[model samples]
Target: MSGRRTTHEDAHDPAPTWTPRLGDLAHDSSADRTGVVVEVPGDGVFSYHLRPERGGADPEWTAPADGSTLSPADD
Candidate 1:
């Protein structure tokens, strides 16, 4: 038999969560801008690059706290 043994904790462990992907819509209340997720990368902190829904030159980078005002955009 294999050497590994199972435990109750292991069985009850939650699965890994997921993050947003490119093309997903998000909003920044502080900036009052709605945009699509252009890129997801770490720049010292976990941040998202967003392309403005109203059209812009370059995507803006923002690091929104876990329970902050940032939220999914309706469009």
Candidate 2:
């Protein structure tokens, strides 16, 4: 068997462009998570938040933007 551990790769489809994280909000660094990019919404802040959302699903904005603002993606 392949010693390499299994990552969050699709079974039928090929691997996604990005990976998926459980609850990482700050999209500062390109993480191994799935999702596009939203506005940073902050100045002087060298960070961004990425969630499994689209259209209007905004990232966290209050505090700890990457704490618990990640919402589920729609089918």
Which stretches in model 1 have alpha-carbon errors above 4 Å? 1-18, 42-46, 56-61, 65-69
* Residue 67 alpha-carbon offset, candidate 1, angstroms: 8.2
lDDT of 2 by residue, 1-75 (tens): 978666556445554343324343333323334454454435764334554434365443332334333333333
Provide TM-scores for the models. 0.50, 0.24
Model 1, 1-75: lDDT tens per residue?
Answer: 887776989878764444556777877677787787776665564666678776768557674534154568775
RMSD list, candidates in order: 6.2, 11.6
Q: What is the C-alpha lDDT of each candidate?
A: 0.66, 0.40
Clashes of 1: 0
Clashing residue pairs in candidate 1, if any?
A: none
Candidate with maximal TM-score: 1
User: Which residue pairs in candidate 2 have backbone atoms (N, alpha carbon, C) closer than 3 angstroms, thus clashing?
Assistant: 19-32, 19-33, 19-34, 20-33, 20-34, 25-66, 27-48
